[model samples]
Target: MSSNKTNALSRRAFLRNSSLAGGGMIIGFNLLNSCKPKVVAEPTIDLASLDYNDFNAFIKIAENGAVTIFSPNPEIGQGVKTSMPMIIAEELDVAWKDVYVEQGILDTENYTRQVAGGSQSIRHGWDALRETGAKAKHMLVSAAAARWGVDPSECSVSEGVITNAAGETLGYGDVVNEAALLEVPEKVELKKPRDYKIMGKNAGNVDIDKITTGKPLFGLDYKTDGMVYAAVVRPPSFGHKLVSFDDSEARNMPGVIDVVTIGEKVRSLLAEDPSFSSKISSSDKVVVIAKTTWQAFKAKDAIKATWEEETPMESTEQHNKILTDLLDGSKFNTMRSDGNIKKAFAEADQVLERTYESPFLPHNCMEPMNFYANVTSEKVHLVGPIQTPAWKAGLVAKMLGREEKDILLEMTRMGGGFGRRLYGDFVIEAAEISQTINKPVKVVYTREDDMEDGIYRMAIKYRIKAGIKDGKVTAYHLKEAAVNDNMYGLIPNFFPAGAIENYQVDVASYKSNITTGAWRAPYTNFLAFAEQSFFDELAEMMEVDKIQLRLDLLDKVKPEDDERIQYSPDRMKEVIKMAVEKSGWGTKPSNVYQGFVNYYCHNTHVAEVADVEIENGSPVVKKITCVVDCGIVVNPLGAMNQIEGGVIDGVGHSMFGELAFEDGKPTANNFDRYRLIRMKEAPVVETYLMENEYSPTGLGEPTLPPAGGAVANALKAATGNRLYVQPFTKTPELLKVPEKEIIG
Candidate 1:
């Protein structure tokens, strides 16, 4: 908030002298500002409306004539920190090397849809940015034409220069003063696919240099004058509410600024009484705001608060029982239904059924969730690792009861946001704290807070059944039982909402104390582990080649002809076939085994074949060959990077990563005990892209589902075992059931 920024230095000095004397000097570091366009006026162009002295939207214009575009989408290693800028430079006709890019402070008009989750950053910004760049180019060419008193058609723009047919040239910077006055063209021609100079060529990420050089661009690196640090004390168990708290001890501690109780209350008019907000109780413990992160962390452990305990809910075992019972009773939301499954089962020679379960997962990004907020009575200023700044700005305005224009959300590079940043809860929390304390505050969530307070990927239980006759597929039925509260509610709309014919997906959310939200691939990450594994079982019983069977099914059941499915079964087949040919389907190496799966989500299609070997009953993925088609790739290199990263992240979660909750408390709170896949565990991944002309879709999530399912299916082939449960471990075998085939 602006008021907080105005008051930060004074409040910090007051606290430092009166409260935190013996404490170490509160560091005040100044960070370099991001580059935004500078709007200037000339005789020919009108720059008054375009140039907002306060909103400088462009970056640098070097003496060599290079331009850098700044975007609000935080690059969190998914390559977006650079990929989005590539689109602008490509259209702007600038040398890739000349363009230096930076993540813009979160400002929606200058950088709309600053959120980076769902892999929608590039897809959403592609067309509009292309037009923006093309229009700018056109304006520059027109300015040159006017100077030469020639038709604009005789002038061409290339390499940051506007030149005439006679080869007379002028740098864009020279004409920008005049171009700023010219009317922007309504419709600038877009480059044809073949004529593209920057989109497809595997250009490396523009931000690679910054990241490799250890640049101070991450949220953790953000700082300001007299900025303080704060850590909220969340509930030990998620659901417990703060009934009362004694912060007297915390107040007396050195470096303790103030311990504030934070809780949400719906409008009194909307809710009967603001008794207890329906939202998850963010810990009611005192917030220890101090001059330093270390001091705040140290004082955090010493703070104490009283919680109103609620009835303990079901354990993992009990939750599993409830889901298993739902599947047994054939009770679910019924996502899809087609032919008479009962008659098909009765007519079949053999009916096979299997149940699968996936544990709750945490998105352990390399960095972590963090935000910096400077709030005051008049305005709010925020910067940090946020995916959707526009969305958060709206929420911040509402939460602060301030005009939306008063809030400035600055986007920074994120450590990671695998559907986690979708919830602006933490961002709003930081903004509110800064507003309450009236200071520039950086809120850092300890690894424990990040993991424990994480909106967990829901634990799901699935039951799959198929009718097989003479080893051929006849009929199929799927029953998926999981939480309906959060991400699962969005699955029906995003992924398999309409793709399957005769598919029955039933969803149920069990009331529990643990807070559940979104993870990487949402339900598909877990559901694919179940659905694709079941398909493998169906393949085994039918004595058919796995890849061929899936292809044949796609040919038979085109999604376009079926109203039950949302995706093109034809496109799904394309990727599956592509992966099969590339991975050498049906070929088994002496030392390695292969498994395959194809799934669609986030408007993208991915099919992967994983080669795995059993090492002491644990399936180790040695190599993964994936085929992805998310339509026209704006940047092939960047898209490939996302696919590769998502695959590795998916592999880690499926095979090893899990969050164990004991009485709603996380078991493995840190990376050491949590067991994430490190560099050593990373498999040799070969990724291929299917070319298509359709509008580009997302690449992040689609690549994830296949990694989990493919690895599981490969494990099935290597040992003739099916591990239905997730985090495939050695001790307990989840996929012990017999294999069955699909009946068409």
Candidate 2:
């Protein structure tokens, strides 16, 4: 399939020239640009003829009054498919029941900020989407006013109907034909928060019915005519390359098509281009293409492949030792510093120090990594789950020596992303296989292949130190060390970096062959665990409630004149107080011990409190209370679901999730080896949203950052023994308490 060919027309030009098919209006708005938010052009429409060829246009109103909003971002179960459309429908004055959502293909010329990572889907698209809807509404109102010879101001829209002061009304469909001919307004006024009829309301996801009915909506469910399947035999470890392969037996096997080996030439090209290489796994692998997925997998298993392992690989134990050594002796680079930390620590009344470690985590997305691609000398066609389609398109264009416009990239509903799909290695692999084989091919990564291929959450270690005097933290120091990349990339402005007076943040890095990429909240995933856990210890040291201690610190932050600090002290306190009140902070049942933590990230404020108890010698999470202030919350139902899912994910990872390695190969290849929190272990999650009129922020990641910390603090409160290591089950002393008490 080739990309839709059209004139080099701007969005305004397209809108002005567009014609409705069945008597309705189609509005196209200029999407956000790469450099800054700028209005590109004015929209226009024509009623003389019916033409529906432009793919850049987003909103469509049918003659039957059915509204279809094309969602511009990938939906990785974060509800962008619904929440984004809700924004447009609210501004367009349409009922939620009438809106249908469709995933728009990646078109950088028509859409800005198309990526779904960093929890930026709703945050980035909020204004642009609203404008698209508001413009459409304006045109419809203008058309009705002209037809009735009434002032446009006298006609108010409600649920796709225009009502005049005389109580006479016209359905949008009735005037849509004329509306299509009207010139697009230079500017349209958007509705205030109070006037919202669809946004912020608890509207169900548009795709929920299809998802519940087991319809094929995800990329794994996507199929096309004459598409073949392929599986790969990747290097057993990082920095290893395929040296030789015997595919005679595999070639003779049933349904085996071909065994294609990705050689050093392509690998070298990827290595030379860091921009393309960074977004994909650079591991060299041999692929087996066949008629079916099962056949491909079986043939891959049957092939005898040998790899040349050049670089030495380190085990998890060795890596941990390296981290410990770095923490002990490395000369760290200062990421941030304020006041004199040495002087404050020297004069402090008390000093508290602790070290925390978190192991590598795999995304373990339910669908694994899969993609479909058909590449020819002329163009490349790709359809799959991708968070950054435009970026992937650029990479593929560069690799194939073609322009990005020649590549047709589309996004399907993803079963789960959690930041894993942000990297488009699997998509690129599919394209490469299809290009080599000269056929449409779908590349599928089995659960084991997905787990061991290593685009994992980096293992991290943190050292925290604080000086307390007169019931106040006088000085603070945080030193972080991680494998491959620095934590600064994920969290450059970590909390308490500017919240404390005599604060200094030191960072160090150790290089490794293991591939690491963003996992959910990235550094905040572990930073929150370590930082909040340290805060809990600090609260105990000061003999104060955890919630109050955080509030006090937030209050202490003096407003900086610089724009670098993105957090507001007032906003932080709001969520903390809300969480405390909603969770009954100090008033839980006698058997329950509650742990509270508040954090700000991804432009969202979240405070979480986990209530736990020691039952049968293990920490039992009874319940969790979450308070989130993610701006206006475009869709309440979707927001709640995201928070709940994030909390459960955090809890699962903290309690029993880890990806260990031996000789640079992942030990946990599948669910059996990598433990995930089961349904029985999940806690009762109660979520509350703070009321606000501010623009929407992110909801996907902020809630998860504090989950691990809250649970860790709760475990400490329950057992009176602090667990500094992640996968709390790894701490033997904490687990031995139950058995020891039983034996005694």
Candidate 3:
């Protein structure tokens, strides 16, 4: 929950007082802030006399029968711009062709859950948006009923037209002015899933044309008349602070305006705010302002700065040693325990143990980190790519000592977020530089700056032991170690947590200077690989098929006893079976080995199957099949795209993603060292969505967890070797293969 102060203007007050404009009606809805109490009763205010607030998103009907819908969440290429508005248009009973979509400004008073992380845009906004459209339809129907002197129940709406039994019809635009004057309704009936007209249908992204035509839609493309480009020369390593700088050479560079050194007060503020700690200039830095971005970059490179260095940082090998020691020791905090684990393990016939490890990964977004800000004594104006504008606004308000209303924050299309933009460090960096220079500044980050000075996905180590007897699993234990925290922070109800009879989970932490945060599916991104790969090993030891072992464990949970399990075993099994059947798991073409993996996360179930072949000693993925049960997919095409992207992203990270550190600085500063999956490496992805009536869940992340596990398991089957470490290319055995046999 947010600690920010609440707004005085309530949703009921805004809707009640909103008036008609240009003979058109505007309808607004209230999204209850999770931290605040839900508004139950409607407010008592006049509907004919007040001005509409442009900050709140709403549906507007004009005299020409055009319906304009405002989408409140940031457009981060997740298709929320089109999908969210589709929800409103479906319930509004409007034609898709008649609708025009626009992005709404950040306003916490009217919009709740504006952030795009956790894949929550569709999950949380479905009910609120549906009711908003239904309310507008109700008002329009009443207006048509009064005009025809007929009962409101006798009016039927279809495609924005209200019709009566006498065959008389009136367009929503014709009666919108009259509807604007009517009393607001407290409740309106919503359409059922079977009757949906626009939702569940394939609609192209609203900004596709602009994106394809190279129109300026991203924050990097933003430009203003007086805007100046700025770049920073930050500390080369973590655990250090800038002491002094000599910028004489930079000052003489071409197009150089001025080199400003940041003060300690702002540095302290940045350090105190966790949202800004990952920024390159968070501690201390010198900023170069110039006429163009290229000039700023060149000038920034010419600056020489002295820093107060702290203790040298440990290398990745040292960190791995720390994790190994923790696993070897008995000191750990037990998170979950069920049945008698000691008795079960002691009584078992065979006990098996294996350890899996993953490296810290960078976001590596295509656009790099950038933001635009204009700070003045009067007010602060900001525009850039941010996942949580409302939260950023609150932070800015506290930093600037200004009212939240005085600060303006706008969102622009992001090139790629993937949980990276959730932190607004870059946004605040731009604001601080603009405030110091007293000019509108666009702060730009080079690829090296963006990669080295950014928060990464925490490197994790997992050790799992299982006890088996009579070819059936008897007990299970899991221990995790990582920097700052453990894997359980994001995934407490990890797979087999409730499936096994005797289970215990423990965690140990090793603090490091490296900063970490959510990346894609967070913990599950790596946990899935460890857990699923271990399950494959277990099946081999037990002489049982992997899929059947999972099904047998799932069958242990009673259908009537709901309190024991965190996830539905039935739903988990459904996806597993779907993936197996669709991919022909038991039958494959010659020279191709198939691997299967299934897991649940983000309130969604996903199962993936990967087909791999050992082509000249290197594993090459030919195709992948993904089955997802997110419940009531709003847009099939967009959902498929999300799944396909997640699969490729997960596989790419598992195969060639690793960020190493030595002496408190990142080793892989740019793409030359940090390898990503190229176009030739991507596999043919086939996706399937389960048909169900449950409310829609998020699809952005659920498909990612299974990708790594499936690919690793497939590689094992193809090459007769297991990959316990991530970035499979790092395996010593694979490196030993002749260079001629290794595919580039």
Candidate that scores best on TM-score: 2
Candidate 1 residue-wise lDDT, 1-744, digit = tens = 000011122222433332222221111101111112332222222222222223323433332354646544676667765666666667778777666664556544434565666767677766766665665677778878999999999988777888898889998766666665565454668776676787777777665555677776678888888899998888777656667766677777788787775554223211442222222354444577988887788778877667766666446777777777766774456555666777778888877799877777777667777788998866788877776677677767766667888886666667777867766557867887787788899888888888877777777787778777666667677676774353363354323333233344456556566666667766577777787888788777777877677776666654555464667777887887788899987777554778888888877888899997655444468899999888888778777778888899889878787777777677878888897777988888899998877778888777887788888888776666778777886324543322321110
How much is the lDDT of residue 349 in candidate 3? 95
Best by lDDT: 3
**What TM-score, over all chains together, does every model reach?**
0.86, 0.93, 0.93
Candidate 2 vs candidate 3, lDDT winner: 3
Q: List residue ranges in candidate 2 displaced over 4 A.
A: 1-22, 33-57, 275-284, 488-492, 560-562, 736-744
Cα lDDT tens digits for candidate 2, 1-744: 001121223334433443343256666775553123343322233432322234344677766777777778888888888788788888888877777676777788767778889898888877777877887888889889998899999999899999998999998878877787776665778789888887767877777777788877778887878899999898887767777889899999999988887644356548667745544456567899899999999999988888877889778998899999998976788877888999999999999999999898999999889999999877788988999998888877777767887898878889888888987888778877888889999999999989888488888889999999787898998888888777623464657756778988888888777888789987688888888999888888889977777777777665575455778788888888888889998887767778888888888998999998767766689888999998898878888889999999999998898888898799989988889999999999999999988888988988888998999888787777888999898886774444543343
lDDT for 118 in candidate 1 is 70
Candidate 2 CA-lDDT value: 0.80
lDDT, model 2, position 641: 88
User: On residues 1-744, what C-alpha lDDT tens digit does candidate 3 reach at each position?
Assistant: 001111123334533532323356666676432112332322112333334453244786776777878788988888898898888889899988778886776777777778888888888887878887887888889989999999999989899999998999999988887887776666678899999989888888888777787877888988877999999887888777888888999999999999996645456666667545543345677899999999999999998889887646667888889989988899888888889889999999999999999888899999888999998888888888898899888777776667988777778889998878887777767887888889999999999988878878888899999999777788999889887667533364557877788989889888767777788887688989999999999999988989999999888876466464556789989999989899998788756788889988887988999998767676688899999999998889899899999999999999889999887788999998898999999999999999999888888888888899999888887767788999888885843333533443
lDDT for 247 in candidate 3 is: 93
